[model samples]
Target: MVQADERPASDTDLITLGRRIRHARTARGLTLDQLGERVGSAPSLLSLVENGRREPRLSLLRAIAEAVGVPLNDLLSTEPPSRRAALEIALDRAQRGPLFAALGLPALKPSQKLPIPVLEQLVGMHQELARREEEAIATPEEARRANTELRLERQARDNYFPQFETIAEDLVTRAGHTGGALTHRTVARIAEQLGFTLLHVEDLPRSARTVTDLRNGRIYLPPASTPGGHGLRSLALQAIAHRVLGHERPRSYGEFLRQRVEITYFAAACLVPRTQAVAFLEASKRERDLAVEDFRDAFGVTHEAAAMRLTNLATVHLGIPLHFLRVGDDGALFRGYANDGVPLPQDVTGAIEGQLVCRRWGAREAFARRDKASEYYQYTDTPAGTFWCSTQTGSGDAGAFSITVGVPYAHAKWFRGRDTPVRRASTCPDPSCCSRPSPDAAERWAASAWPSGRMHQQVLAALPRGAFPGVDDAEVYAFLDKHAPEQ
Candidate 1:
């Protein structure tokens, strides 16, 4: 679906579009031909317009409204923000098309004058109804369904794709960066071999770690601001995935995310070659519990990468069912991929990403350590089941982050820290998981808590809530801004 980033500031009036003529006509019990006769348009043509297959001339749309006994604006507006904004875009494009010329509709811009009452109705739709709709899901089950679908897709692969692994291995071998170590020099050589242009900008926006300017064919890398110096190569591979895999504009949010999953998997597989990684893991698992830091140290990758690589090995190589978590210092889960069918925290929209995880999990508790250099492991019992996890702390562009790899307690014997003295029990999804504020708990740590830690951010500059939930528009802005066509 086309993203609604181009919704004009002056076009806020178009938001409500509370009703569709199709809905109004169905309410009136009139057939398409009956309405077409009243509006002097063909039934087939009217159908095309309603389904977004054909654009109705402005005059024809007005006639359709008058025939249906609904205001013209009501016929044009849809309830969803993107749909309503798309109507405006469609109308603008239609006005500039050949059909409008044939119909003799006057040349007009989006700002051109129209009846004030129509304008007022548009404003009402844009302001009131759309705002309410934005905060909620059309169907509560939909959010849950979306998360389920993503989970199913992840399980479908069982966390391994030999096709992508083959591509990664082949690329690295051809670049002569095979065996022993995977370093920044290795990533650089592969990037140059792949003909990627890396540009480190003087004024790189701190808000974004990397930007892809496809227009200029340059990947903008953030400076040494991020602690791990491996971000540039990772970012370049991510950018390369779009072109390498011939990705197209996603028709839906899920499809967009699926593309992202494929890209990250490919990038990770490239950095930690399948043949080498599997061999290294086999040796490590046999020697002792597999330590993720050793994997990270071997491949100069981020802690998050090492965690993901562990899961990547589970299905084909390790025969272990694992779960991965990318938890932020603030307790938000940036990523959750599990093949074990364990219950993970989900946001209001039923997404694991961006959901606030239970504080007792190793991923969250690792952040509380006085000695972060030391590895942490937790044998935690949850309502779903017990999981043994290994967590390590890291600093990234998103601030302090935790990368964790966990397997069901039965499989813990295969991982490092499985026998560690650390342990915790969690009753999350039940209000008792230690999230809610209580008087006794507050008193004990009241002095230590930041008394004035509230950010109190201004909402004036924030982007409007659109179709997707938990999407940060600033990231979208950075991505699109970097990739927008050259003027």
Candidate 2:
């Protein structure tokens, strides 16, 4: 007695195998009935196998191969015998897939009269549908994991990307930026060089910072009077960076996060061209007067962007490993990166986003200062090692946040904030550090307090669905339709 092959095969694999068997039989000038007779099988049953409607037993496959004068391996090959057979197999698999069943569409039967172009078009549509469905269903956990992986990768490289630096330098040269802070006029020149026209629109999509109409060579941005208008140059450059980098629709959450990082780095590099920024940094280091505020002023960027740019250049160019953090007033870690062994709070997934930062760190302590006009500096002793940090407070629509940059105690001597008198010890990743209440306070308030917790909806929700996650496709399309000039 012979058994069917117990190993599971996908519908696609089985379909391809069946097509190969049929092709082999036909090539040998044998009809199904004649082949079935030789293999001791009925013609009708052989027809079912030939059509991919049934799985033939291993012994029967061997007999069929023998009767068709083809090697068993040839019949078992997964490749379709020809292009038409490949298209038929794809269509059949798509029809049997869950997406097709969910749509409740009538299946198209493959016949000699079905045009090859029609088959190609249908298969292409099905492939796109499958890709979009996958993109839509990426859960929050997947997004977190992807972000965590990206952070680790960037951290390993000290957040420095020389290729993006080269691209930015080239673009800046093309824009005629000879040095100093990259101005808005120069940024516009860069866009023009890239074949894009800058169009300030009041009705730009709320979810998007910048929208590029690739078809019409237009980039739409919020007017300069907007709250985030200070960063318009960076935003416009980020939009153009996508086109410059040849970014395609992301197939997974990881790819999206990667593209986001790449574009952000490119934008920052363009804002503070590497050669100029590094020279200024090297001078600051030599003077032992390195400061994020000065960097921000020189580059005409926000404190956060300056801090991030410092991380991008510190270890690679200045020979100093550093860490950067953006913490909310409520102590949540919005963004963090470190190459200097600074201990950052992270979940089991290694994600720092949304995790509550230690109150003892400079990022949180900066918020408590009465004078918000100046940067706050501190020395924090942690389980890993002591670190010196400088933090600056700023507010946006989402309320207050602190941007911080730090280095290990050894490297702190080169920074201006090294003389700060404020010092604190942090035992983070330990509940007692800042997470747990003090014994006296807990005894007094634990039984009396009944305050309702403020919830963050995004924490409990899945990542927004789309080719570019968090973007509304309908809104973007409608905006383009409303703004597109008559063609």
Candidate 3:
């Protein structure tokens, strides 16, 4: 019986072996006919094997090895016999690749007359084309899966990252920040310390929130007075954090999501330093008055940012497990994170974004309130457990949204809204739980109501294709070229 080593190797390995056999045959001063005659094979068959067009049987390989005066193991070696052989094998494999076949171009034959430079250039171009093809293949479903996986990973760590905290602390300290609002001046200092100059541009790319010119050591951002909800200090810090964290162009959607999480975490840490935020939260907990509004006011950041920052530090430092959610007015989830046992709605892909929130939850309930000026608080009882949440409503270019921070019932004593009487019961993941209409309502309107649905264009479209998805590469390049200073 044939041994495991006698089994045919993979196609790639066979290609390398074929090149080695050809090199050995020529070194032994034998033609294909002479070698094949010794191995009891036809010259045409030997030629096919030598050119990587066919695979030889193990017995035939052993016979050829003996005829060529080389060890059997030498014929099985993975490396090409020489640099020229390596280039030739690469060209052959590239031509066989799916990307090349998709182009419908005829394959080029590598010959002794082909110069090394031409082979190198051809191989390099094929490699680049393969990379671009890979980037173009990212789909919306792939992006959703990546987002789901990243959310689960962050949830495992209680949504906190100490490494980013340490980096932010060091940068803030060097910038001479002594707590309080973390003013724009201090953020600028941090950027300058990292060898970057912040430039407010009127013509920044529409798709980009901020752009970094690595060659010119510049960061371009929208003007401070611009109505976009993103804070100038936060945007600038996020851009600089990318450089500080040594981030590179993401090769996959998963890497891109991870890098975005890291940079945003770094910026949040800088905006609300861990040392200060932790101390404040600890004090609030001691007073049994932990409130997101106070946290937002103290840090001079937005309500959503403050609530998200709570998710980053509450469980890790304050010993309080909780959940955070950002829900749109239409009751669809935009973002969600939980270390507490509360169950959030998710689709088949395990993605929570764009999934409908239970109508009974605090996130959706807050949208019904007439008083948009004040925070809404509620207690929700779910299958997992009871949670008390505080939600704040805000509007942006996209529309209205509610940001909610919730803790399990047992941990509610440390928060301010624990005494509120508003409460709800939910049985989500069940079809009857806020998803189906009541018997009377369904009988009245289900048959007669024919509503037009607003289709989400992004859902039907493929994910943006490029190293940085959704960014217009041509516009960015043109902007840079126009603004680049003379050398």
Candidate 4:
């Protein structure tokens, strides 16, 4: 396995790299001063780095790499002098183009920051080559021609897309919007929905600077931060917007480039809502019951959001029983719970199979039969045999009941269909083997653990609904107290 730190860096032609960085910086409308703030260097030093006049120290190079958003290898060449020298002249000349300079202030070499349309044409060439490769087995001549063309296109795109991120942002900001909502999941969904590919580069080797010449269907983003707080994301976003979105002509790249512009802070808030929920939870502790509807009203969120909030609330505060309460005559376990102070296993979300088994045995029966020596026990025989293993925690006022339960459900859904085999399905049929041993075993696992909404409603509907009224904490504690394990 290639450990990340040992991975070799980019070996792009250095002169080409200089031109690429200079062109990208200018296109983003950032002055030396503005860019300086991001990369943490004086404008003159930045100017020298862009012009290839100064050999940037490793520290400075890493910063510039992050600010320009190209990988370190993209900026500094590791290729042998013979190969690198041959490419440098063309790269340097290409960087001198007025089109590259027009995007911003000119640095020494400027021609290489070519138009996005040019890059797109190159991608079309690659696609054609790939298709042809399948038809004719490559002769020596054909293979050489194909390899040269692909390398040229890859280098061009690698140098330009970092600038595209900037252009995309400008267009979006101009249209009175921001990037998509910012949660791990929502950001992913939005990127896919917009036909944008997401790649994480924070784990790449030698900290190569990232580039995203979108015209070439390439995006480069750093895996982690460099000195001066510069990261691949900022650079990649800048490159994505400026290089990809700035075209005057109509193009397919713009569709992707424009999609990124639609991302907005408001949309992001809907996904995370951290600030809004934290405040509301802090205030709700004063209330006695902490009803879901009441939390919804207080937080100005939907009832479901309120339920989510309750689970989150426990992450911040301890000693609260604020469960996203779902009840039916069948049984009541936490659908969503926040214990506030409990330490628990991270993989508790899909522990319902175990709970169903315990419920089948009847809480009363499990408590009566609880024995430390008991290894295997039956919970139910009808419908399908249900099995359970039981465990308890603490004693006296601190005693807790834990029963691992399992019952047969439609295995097809678990496997996504009957045709496919189930993978890594949980094996917690034995009560003793169920429930990870952790203090927050209940709460940590409960957060986002339940399949609620429609599936939960179905589970509720299957039960005798009206048989159980909304029970109080005291009643709940009283019922459990009877079942509590003896000292």
Candidate topping TM-score: 3
Report each candidate's C-alpha RMSD, comma-separated, in the order given: 12.8, 9.6, 10.2, 28.9
Name the runs in model 2 displaced over 4 angstroms.
1-104, 107-138, 226-229, 444-448
Cα lDDT tens digits for candidate 3, 1-487: 8776566655448788889999999999999989978999999998889888887878888899999999988988999999999999999999998779968999999877899999999999998998766654557787788889999999999998999999999999999999888877788899888889999989998878899999999999988784533498889998998899999888777788788999999999999999999999999999999999999999888999999999999998989999999999999999999989889899877899899999999999999899998889999999998999999999988999999999999999999989999999999989799888899999999889999998888887776666587788888898899888899
lDDT values for all models? 0.70, 0.88, 0.90, 0.38
Cα error, candidate 1, residue 433 (Å): 3.8
Clashes of each: 5, 0, 0, 56
- In candidate 4, where is summed lDDT lowest over 10 consecutive residues? 462-471
Instruction: Residues 208-288, candidate 4: write the lDDT tens digits.
Output: 333333332444455443432212333434333333334232222222223333222122123324444445555654432
| TM-scores for all predictions | 0.61, 0.74, 0.75, 0.20
Candidate 1 lDDT by residue in tens digits, 144-198:
4555576667677887878888988887888887575566666667667766667
- Candidates sorted by lDDT, descending order? 3, 2, 1, 4
After superposition, candidate 3 runs with Cα above 4 Å error: 1-137, 226-230, 444-447
TM-score of 1: 0.61
Which candidate do you rate higher for TM-score, 2 or 3? 3
lDDT (Cα, tens digit) per residue for candidate 2, span 250-356: 87777887889999999999999999999999999999999999999887888888899999999999899999998999999999999999888898778899999
Worst 10 residues of 3 by lDDT: 3-12
